[model samples]
Target: MSLSSTPPNTSTPIEDPSVYLDDPNRKSLEIDTDTHQGPALFRWLTLGMEYLIGAILVALIVSVSSNVVGRALFNHSLPWADELARMLFIWLVFIGAAAAFSRYEHIAVDALVRRLPLRLAHMLYLLQHLIITGLMMVMIWGGYQVLERSSGRSAIMNVPLSFISLSLVLCVIFIAAVSIWRMWVSLNVIRHPEGER
Candidate 1:
């Protein structure tokens, strides 16, 4: 048996400042108002709100399920439980979707994008932002119209339909904000030589 000894290579990692710089194309554009200098406070606020809503949804589901199970096993049903659960489920879907946008966790098809060159990928990202912004604007306008038209209608709980419709407005507003933020970032990457992402 022969023993061989070799020194392992140890080298310091190189840091690239360009990764920290903003894109040149977007430098002339207005800075994003969404991102403030207050210690990322808004992020935490939004996150808290999102989690609270999620918890409410989960609790509603659990309560509804328990009620249903109790009624089935005991031969007595809570008539309102199903309706209440449905409403909460609706709210959960819309609010959760909106929250996804805020956190940049929404599903996106980027398989082709991943194969593209860095510059092209950036351009595609900018295009995606523009498309999303337009879509959100449409949703906001349409939701407002629907709310106005359904002003007199009421849900099972006698709640105004507009209350439910307002969820669309809230979702659109958040989505638009996220889209604008994305656009701002894309523009910055295009502007400053050192800001390329």
Candidate 2:
């Protein structure tokens, strides 16, 4: 992909790969999942979550690397590394799930929707998002119940297993919020004929 920054007085001819100059300050981009404009709090929360997940990933990598080097050099593995990796992975799975859902990156069959008429397609899209929100709601409740029943500590780290419960709850809540927002936007799209998406 080609990208160029134009000088204040100069304008480049539009050619080659398509470019979207929607936001003047470049706070967000057309190619980014942040293009879905919503509440400021929601956007900031998602942005913060993305950064938090990235940090977790980096920590996981460092933990694994240190553990491996320790094992090879001193013939001893850092027991805490295993638990750290496991916990980080658990958090990653739940946290990354929200971003994926918001960006519509989840696997889905779209051929049927693509074939439908504009109105029907939007309706189906709204219904799909609503269903996703409902499912995530269920998951939140079930996850909470499960967390309530859990009392075990980690085998090596001795940390309470209940710690990861927050991750599950937060992820599902964020996913549900995004689905609801998308459903609202889909309804608006249906009301105003914006030609098909």
Candidate 3:
């Protein structure tokens, strides 16, 4: 006796991820990390950022939870908990953003671009990445200035304020590098749409 609630449809073939590259008309996001295109070092950096973001998130949770429990049960607060949590939260946001950008996971409105010719679409993509790179450069400069001027420590934890600004600078630097690389890829596709892979 078969234990199936309903028979599966075995006639349909599984779609291969590589097929997207072969079809110019396919307008899909590349969500598979196995097929990620980049130098090994860059890929490693993105993976590291993802791991760091997770660790920071866990630390942030623990800090807040311990403080809450202490206040409720012991009628005493962990003074350093709030400051540590805030610092971890800042790191999480910046690192998470960099990881998301590396994977092209950020929200974007590309309906019009999807409908355009492949070369024309890539032209727009190149322009978009150029603007992003420029903005990131400005952010890096501003972050560096802030880091230099931030001489004070956190109120309770005594952690240096420059540590917080360092996160912003590092995040923008990675994002800017990614933007430049993406711009180069877009430029290549514009020059040779048939050679895209």
Candidate 4:
């Protein structure tokens, strides 16, 4: 038999993004939530946040595209387009981050943790979530202070600056809550490893 010269195809198959968006069971979209390991409250909250993020993204696209079209075709810009797009983008980034966190979609290096004993792995997880919660708390406090000092409205849209600051506060609040829940779950697993089975 003659040896083939072709190299093997080792690339992973790419998933269709629209399939997840259109699926009724959105829970399957998440990596680790396939077995219903996440709490019900968070599942609902994540679904709602995903919808909100999608709406904000669509609005942002429309806002920016309309401005571009107006400028190109009419030689004039929509006065409010820039401000509206900015606000939507801010909300999108903050809320998208919270949603991604809930889905455990952020970049992570957990190869070592995966190989460790259950108790030790969970202990590490608890510590990690604790740090995240603490940082989120600090962000929440700082965001509130900014909101208090933000007295002016957006120049074009007449929306209060505090509205923008509120998105940051809300994002951290969701992340902090999720971190606390994860910490509790990790502590439970550490205490009763059998219960996890």
Candidate 5:
């Protein structure tokens, strides 16, 4: 066969985005990363949360495992272990939630969003985040109020129940900030649907 002008294995340039999108292995095009420089404190705080969550998880595993082994082998349980595991479990849950929110991976039903117009979808998305922010703010306030009465100390650890209440406050703070960030990003997308992306 006669040689064509184009070289071998040279795929045709994509004129329509749909053609490129059909490729399962195609790398995603960069969108908001170019102009989106979030706050320095937010970045550092998320990073610290990553490390803290990891440590808490590890401690939780160790405490539970050791408690199990101690009871099985020595017939004597570590009295502090049950309490330590409980506290660490709470911390782990809250920290893990914060990390998930920061990454925007929390659960949501999005079947309806896919069918909406692009502008309306962005608007609704931002509204969803605003609602979450408002709800979490109420949770944080309520948690603080109730924490005043949960002042009794843990029987084994002697740590006040208020400390556990603080975990709820911390979790909601991260979630609220992340929800706000998501809303801000959605607003930007709505305003500049063509350029910002």
Candidate 6:
């Protein structure tokens, strides 16, 4: 076949990691060696608070279970135990969600992007964060409105519904902030001198 007429090969060899590993001349690239103390302290404090709340939740669960068991055996029911358990559960769910958001451990599907090019993958990550942050802001605003409207009402134990609603407001704000922070970190990584591969 003439050189100009030959069909081009469709397959190309993938870049070898060994090239970078074996080359001594290439300078080792370090990303984000400088620690931002404020973010680090916030992260640690948030995690510590989550752990404390988790311990309280465990204690609440154990106490509720014991009360329920004792009441069942004694043919009597504790009126406040169920309500307290429900409130504790609500607290646990919201606080747990906040913790997950802070840690970037929320559920997501990335199967389609896994096969894409690196730049596209990072772009997709940014897009996801943008959507998340927008949604969280909306939720925070809506939750605050609801809390304000329901401030005078009280739950079965005379607890204000607004108090519980405030948790939703806080959770949304925290989720949005965490999403934005993570996006900032990712952008910084992309802009680093040794850009992400």
User: Which segments of model 5 are wrong by more than 4 Å?
Assistant: 1-37, 114-117
Write the residue-wise lDDT of candidate 2 on 86-118 in tens digits: 899999998888766654556766666655666
Which of the predicted structures, 1 or 2, would earn the higher lDDT when compared with the native?
Answer: 2
How well does model 2 score by local distance difference test? 0.74
Candidate 3 backbone collisions, by pair: none
Score each candidate by Cα lDDT: 0.67, 0.74, 0.80, 0.83, 0.74, 0.66
Per-prediction TM-score, please?
A: 0.71, 0.76, 0.83, 0.83, 0.76, 0.71
Against the true structure, candidate 3 has what lDDT?
0.80
Candidate 5 lDDT tens digits, 30-114: 1122343466566667678889998898888899999999999999999999999999888888888877666445665556765
The stretch of ten residues in a row with the least summed lDDT in candidate 5 is: 23-32
User: What lDDT does model 4 reach?
Assistant: 0.83
Model 1 TM-score on a 0 to 1 scale:
0.71
Give the winner by lDDT: 3 or 5. Answer: 3
Q: Tens digits of per-residue lDDT for model 1 on 17-113? A: 6543433333322223265422253366466658878797777978698787988898787766776676677677778877666654566555676
Estimate, for each residue in 39-144, the C-alpha lDDT of model 6 and write its tens digit: 7645674667578687968878886987788787987777767777777777778888877665545664545655555545555666777898999989988997
Point out the worst 10-residue segment of candidate 6 by lDDT.
24-33
CA error at residue 104 for candidate 4, angstroms: 0.3
* Alpha carbon deviation, residue 112, candidate 3 (Å): 0.8
| lDDT winner, 1 or 4 | 4
> Model 5, clash count?
0
Highest-scoring model, TM-score = 3
Tell me the deviation in Å of residue 17 in model 4: 17
Give the total clashing residue pairs for model 2: 0
Task: Go through the candidates in order and give the clash count of each.
Answer: 15, 0, 0, 0, 0, 0
lDDT of 3 by residue, 25-120 (tens): 323223235776576667889888888888888899899999999999999999999989888888888999988988777877666776678888
Return the clash pairs for model 4, or none: none
- What is the clash count of model 4? 0
How many residue pairs in model 1 have overlapping backbones? Answer: 15
Best by lDDT: 4
